[model samples]
Structure formats: structure tokens, C-alpha cells
Target chain A: MKKIIYLDNAATTEIHPDVLNEMLPFFKKMYGNPSSIYSLAKSSKRGINLARERVAKALNASTKEIYFTSGGTESDNWAIKGIAFANEKKGKHIITSCIEHHAVLHTCEYLTKYGFEITYLPVSEKGIIDVKELERAIRKDTTLVSIMFANNEIGTIQPIKEIGEIAKKNNIYFHTDAVQAIGNVSIDVEKLNIDLLSLSAHKINGPKGIGALYIREGVNISSMIHGGMQEFGRRAGTENVAGIIGLGKAIELSTNDITRKTGYLKELRDYTIDEIVKRIPDTIVNGDRVKRLANNINICFKYIEGESILLMLDHEGICASSGSACTSGSLEPSHVLLAIGLPHEIAHGSLRLTLSKNNSKEEIDYVIERLTAIVKNLRELSPLNK
Target chain B: MEEYSKEVIEHFLNPRNVGEIKDADGVGEVGNPVCGDIMRMYIKVKKDIITDVKFLTFGCGAAVATSSMVTEMIKGKSLEKAEEITNINVAEALGGLPPIKMHCSNLAQQCVKAAILDYRKKHEK
Candidate 1:
């Protein structure tokens, strides 16, 4: 088999060896349930507590503020629905950006059925929301503002601090789905005035089924899962001890030297973007270059569909993702791309290559070379090519 | 990505009849870029038979493979016989496409029929 070049790190990452090692003990010797009263279960409880503490420390929050859940999608569902349900009496209005993940957008859409009015603020062509627009969208009855930390498709980071301040001044709860930004971007919940934040472990080289939501100490959010006393009675489920331990270790390792890790990824990302643009004709870079994630590169090649490019790249052992309608199950192009004012044709040709620290310069170089050839060959076969 | 048949992958990686015939007797174009797929078929007819056929397509693997397969299937056939070819035949020739991509085969069939129609329209005068 050919050696693989995995460029779809944003989708999910390989579990770190250290994280796996930490999790293995939980599955074997420490198999007792944390909810059990037996002495054997004490170790499991300790493991969960330590994991919570690590997650809290990464975001500069108290241990009590973090609650474990299934993954980013659940965290998002819980955060948005929790705040919406708890404060509906105060206001039935919620404000969020149009470019959020389906996890958040769908939740907001669901609320409309319950008599809640949601305002989806628009973004600029670069995929950044206008702070003034968000402020203007806020209403007297607005109880929550949910925006994503960074876009998963285009890697555009939002003005989180500004949004947080606006939410704070309006006395509205601020929730951000930080699934894509957690390990790469340093976040301080208190400093940023964030009321709630969501993150997933899988994106940071941890286990797939575990994630956390940080709720500020005084937030009045209702329980998303109603069951036994777990996650301070806010989220109820049997503790995923092994997954928790893995998340703890992964977060610690990723955040311990985030500056260096992000700097290294930024270099590779810049090199990849510059090489692709220089070698290819009519290639348009997506998102804000300066405000984008360090590891993401989204580009559009004119006159060709993204799925063909991805298929040819896969033949070369390079894994990437695209926003083309043909690739996604839905017939429409990516909502995130469309929200940024991209025409449907241009959106269908977009390619996203999210890097990881483990990827090497040699791998990127080979990808650039193959990508240039693939684009050229596809253009030759494209009827739209002139 | 959805799993594709080995034949589909084979044809996509090395699509056949992948260019245009500048002086072709008939041309057919179908689909739009907004839909993430488009195909243009060109044919050179001699004595009411398709002596040569080629295609250019911008789409996913399925779309390109279907266009390639249609061109190969009709190269030596008469215009009326080529018009008789259906999307199902095109799909079966390619071993079968995923259910969602069945439309890509339809695009190929429509393109070929359009080309044949174009050929007939030219000779009607």
C-alpha cells in the first residue's frame, strides 16, 4: 500500500500515543463505574475529576465549570438548547451567526418551532461577522448569542472577544462552539467574558466520543440530559472513564506548547497555500488569511468540481475534504460557503486541506506537486475550461 | 467519501475520449456548474454512423466516468441506435453507480441524445 498523506485533520485526528496509554488503564484495571460506591470505583471517579480539571485548566476555568458530554455535536446541542430553555421566560429571542456549524444552526432552527425567534447575523465575504451587525441584531428580548470560535470549512476565526463583550454588555448569554479552535487557539473563558463554550476531544488527537462544555459559574442553564446524578446533575450519562482520561492527556499535551505547535502548523499552511496559488491558475483562496486558523487552507480552482480533484488526490494517497454539493449528501453547496457570499459554482469547486503538526514539509511538497497536476488534468477535461 | 465500485474508480482515474473534436458534426452540453456537474459531448459522424466521439466534463468521479463510458459505448453506433441507449445501460456498463449518483448516468444519456438530435437537426435542411 502507498504511504498516506492525511490532510483532513480538521475532520478527525489520530489518537496520540500518550493519550491512548492513559486511556488503556481505565479500560482494564480501572474498569469500575464512577457511579458505584465500592472502593474499586474510586479510581474511576478520580480519573474523571482529573480530566475535568485538565479541561478547565486549558480554558482557564474552574473545575466545576466543565461538564463532559458525547462530542462537539452534543455539547453544541446542550449549550444552545440549555440556555434557550432556561431563559425563555426572560426572552424568546436568540442571535447567532449564519455561518455556524449545522449543530448550532439546526438547534436554532428547531427553536423556531417552539415560538422562539432567532436572528442569524450575516458575515463578510471573508467569512467574518461584522461586530456592528451583531450588536444591531441584539433585541431587548434576546437571551443568548451563539457564534462559533472558528469556521471548520474555511478556517476563518471570528472576533470572539468582541462578540463576547457585546453579549456581556447586553446581559445576554454568550455560547461559542469551539470544536475547531480548542487546542490550536488559547482561550480564557473569564477573560473573554464567555458564558459557555463547547469543545471536542477527537479533533485534538484524543478519543472520539468525549467532549466538554464550559459553563460560567453563575449561568442559569437547564440540564440537556435528564438522568442520574452525573456532571453535577447537568449532564447525565455513565462516565466514559477511558475517553475522559484520553481527553485530559490530549488536551494537556496539545495546550502545553500551543504557541510552538500552532507556529509550526502556520508555516506549513502558509507554504501549502502559497505553493498552490503560485503553481495553479485562477485559484482563489477562501476565508481571511490573517484571521484564519493556523492549520487550514481552503482554495477554489476555477472550471472544475472539487470532488474530481479530491478523487484524483486520493489516488495519490492524499486525503482532503471539499464543500462541493456532490461530495456532501445534500444537493446544495456548503451553507458556510454560501453564507460568505460565494456563488454556488465557486462554492462547488472549493477544497479544504486542514493540516496537523505531524505533517511534514516533504508531504506538503508532494501534495502541491500532485495537486498542480490534478487541477491541470481536470481542467483539460472540464467543458467549462476555455 | 461514499464507496465507489472498482470499475468506477478505474474509469475516473483514466477517463476515455476526454477531449473535443474541433470540427465535430454535433455537440451536446448538459448540466450547470451550480449543480456541481456539467458535460459536453462532441461527435464526428460519417455516413450516418458515429465514427468518433469525445467528451469534456466537470463533475465528481461518477459524472466523469459516466461521460467517458457513454462516449466509448456509442463511438461505432448509428445515431438512432445511440439514441436508444438509456441511463440504465450506461450505469450497467460502468458496473453500477451509487444511488445518489444515478443522476450522473442520466446526464450522460441526455448528453448523447442531445448530440444525436443536434446531428439530425443539421441534416434536416
Candidate 2:
């Protein structure tokens, strides 16, 4: 059997066994609609409620504030559009960072057609947004400030609490797309003064297509999906029962011992980063040295494109991702890397290897071995190497 | 990788005629690194017949595979015949690249043509 080493946890994670076990009954025997008022429906309703509670607990939010969505994309769309439309009367301006995930950036772009002014704050060379710049970007009509808790590509953790504080002082609602931050970084919505936040289950060893949005009680955001009374009438459609259950169990397991889980992941991440930089010449470790996700190791190899490296790695039973334009399905390199001031050529050579608890020291060593050879070989085949 | 044809993956994994011809009669370079693909082709022509061809590329799988395939396609062919080879021919020879990767084939064809053009320019002078 081929030995597969899955390292793209930020893209999505393998479901935890415990989460899968908890969700099994919901998909088979206890398959009842949560909206249906019957005894069988009680199990489904209980499952959703528990998942919502788990999500709320992780963010230090109240159960009433949590509303399940399809996933991070939907949650991001809901939060950004909901806040933008609802507060249009108050103000038509929104502030966000340049390095946010496409989920937030595209949503902000879409809002532009509706005459909602947006300020995309630039990040420093290390991909950290300037808090003072964010403060200055805020206008009197800036009704909301939306920034991602962490970047999906480079894994740079933004100063969300500082942004949240600025938004609070300016009397603007703050929303954070925390899809990549869940389980990786500890966040408390209350302490951060975050009015709206988006998170997904798939990033933390849970099922895909299940996520939650946290909305402060007094915040007046309009519902994104409407037709059914599910999710307190904020979101509509039949609940993803099994997914919700898996998310509940996954969140509980991941957050129960966050310190230990992150500590172990950090050791692996740092080791991998250090080894790659040391072993390979002309290799750069992207993102901040610290204040980044514990599991992320983004690097750019000089003189070779990323997809070729990814292909070679894939051949060796390794799974990873890249910020190269060829892999992006669009012919543009990662905006995050570009925003951080990397040249287009270097950005094209970017590789993102996001780790998980399942990864180990041995796997990292093997990856270093294979990666060193791949980089050396590809550089030999590169025209720019001359 | 699934989007790539088996031929593309095969060619990419074992790219042929890689590296440069140090003292080649003609050398051509095309495409930009900004677009994530840059291909350089070197050709050695003897008595109006292509004697040897090699390429070096900095790009994705498609770019490398296409460069490899084009070099193989034009290696022993006459300059006139190699000049007739289009991007379509290169892509077809590799069982077709994805629409997004068609540019790689174009880069390959352009690179070969650029080398041929260089050969012709030197001789024409």
C-alpha cells in the first residue's frame, strides 16, 4: 500500500475518528429532520443544538449567536453581505485587509456594485496588516471592518484583537473570517469585541460543508438564506445533521486541549521550516517567523515553478498546496504573496505545506529529503537558473 | 494533477531533452516567469537538418511536459518541418492539455519557432 502523508490541513483535514463515530448514528438510524416536530426529530435537533453550543463555546460566544451555514465561504458571504446590507442606512463603507481569503475579498468586491465603499488595508512585508493604517482607513461612513483572523495561503495571523478594538472605538461593527484560525489559534469573540465571525469545521478534523457564523445579539444583520425557520430563521434549508454532529465532536476534541495540540504542531512546523531553509539553497520561509499558524510552512524555491514541485511531491505520496498561478486555476499568483511584495516569479514558486496533528517528525524528515532533491533537480531544469 | 492527461504527467515526470545545448547554433527563449512559465529551447542544426534539440523550462507540469514533447517532436526534423509545427500539434501530441494549460503548449511552440527563427537569422545574415 502506498504511504500517504497528508499535510494540507488548511485546505481541509481528514475527519477525526471520534467525530465520525459520533456522526454515524445521525446519518443512519437517527436520520430525522431537525425542523420536524416529532420524537425522532428530537435527536436531530439535539445534535444541531449541541454542535451550535460547541461552536459558540470555542469562540466564547452564546448559543443564541451561532447559526450554521454550508461552510466557510457561505459563512463569510453571510457575515459580509448581511452586515453590509443591514447597515447600509447607517453607512455604506467597509474596511478589510488585502491578505484576506478570497471568500472575504470577493464578497467585499461584490458589495462594490451596490455602492458600498471598501478599504483594502495593505499588509507589511511579513503579511501583517498595519493597525494604524487600518485605523486611518476607517471613515465616518465605515459601518463595518472585516478582516480574516489568519491568512489561508501564508498562514499569517493578523492582529484581530487590535483591529477589533479600533472598530469598537470607531463604533463600527467588526467581522473576522476565522476559517483557518479555528483550532490553530485561540479566539474569544467577547474579549476581542468581534460583532461577527466566520468559521468552518473542515479545518479542524471535522466533516466538510458544516460551519457556523457568530453574530452578536444586538447586531442587526439580515438573513442570507430565507425560506425555512431553521437556524433561528437566519439560515434556511434542511440541516446537515451528520455534518453538524461531526463538527460538534470535532470542535470539542480540538479545543479541549488546544495548548498541547498547538504546541506539538508548532514543534513540527518550526522543524520543517528550519530543515527546508537549511538544506536547500535559495529557499525562503514565508509569513512571519512567529505570530503565524503553528501548522503552516509556506516557502518559495528560487528559479522553479510550484506546480512541478507539487507534482513531484504528489508522486512521492505527499499532499500539499501551492500559491502558484498555474495551480490557482487562474493565471495569477496568490494575492497574499503578491501583497507581501514578492515578485511574480518568486510567487510562482511558492509552496504551502500546512501541517496537522497527524503529521510527524519522521514525515517532515522524509519531506525534507524529497523536497531538497526536487528543488535541486527543478532548478537544474530552469532557464532562469542560468 | 488529475486535470492533466496521462501523457502530460508521464512526460512531466520524465521530461526528455531537458537542459541547454551549450554551443547550440540557435537558441530561443519565450514566455515570462510572471505568468509562471518560461521556456528556453536550444537547437543544433547540421546541413539544414536538425541535429539535436534541448530545452530548459521554469514552469508548471504542463509547461515542462510541453517543452519536453516539443523538443522530441522537432529534434531530427528539418527546420521547415519544425516551423510548421503549431501549438495545436504540440498539445495533440501530448493527448491535449486542459484549456487553462493551452498556453503552455503555445509557449512550447513559440520557443521552438524562436529557435528556428534564430537559426534562420544567423544563416540569412
In terms of DockQ, the best-performing candidate is 1
> How much RMSD separates candidate 2 from the native structure?
1.0
Q: Is the docking of candidate 1 incorrect, acceptable, medium or high quality?
A: high
Worst 10-residue lDDT window, candidate 2 chain A: A249-258
Q: Candidate 1, residues B35-92: lDDT per residue as tens digits? A: 9999999999998899999999989999999999999999999888899999999999
Candidate 1 vs. true structure, TM-score: 0.99
Segments of candidate 1 deviating more than 4 angstroms? none
Question: What would the per-residue lDDT of candidate 2 be over residues A1-386, giving only the tens digit for each residue?
Answer: 59999988889999998999999999898998988889999999998888888888998989999988889999999999998998898889999988888888899999999999989999999999999998889888999898889888888999888888998999999999988888888889989999999888899899999988889999989988889888888899999999988888888888888889899999999999888999998987889989899889999999999999999999999999999998888989999999999999999999999998878899889999999999999999998998
lDDT of 1 by residue, A1-386 (tens): 99999999999999999999999999899999999999899999999999999999999999999999999999999999999999989999999989999999999999999999999999999999999999889899999999999999999999999999999999999999999998889999988999999999999999999999999999999897989999898888898899999989988988898899999999999999999999999989999998999999999998999889899999999999999998888778899888888888889899999999889999999999999999999999988887
Q: Where does candidate 1 clash, by residue pair?
A: none
Candidate 2 local lDDT, residue A372: 96
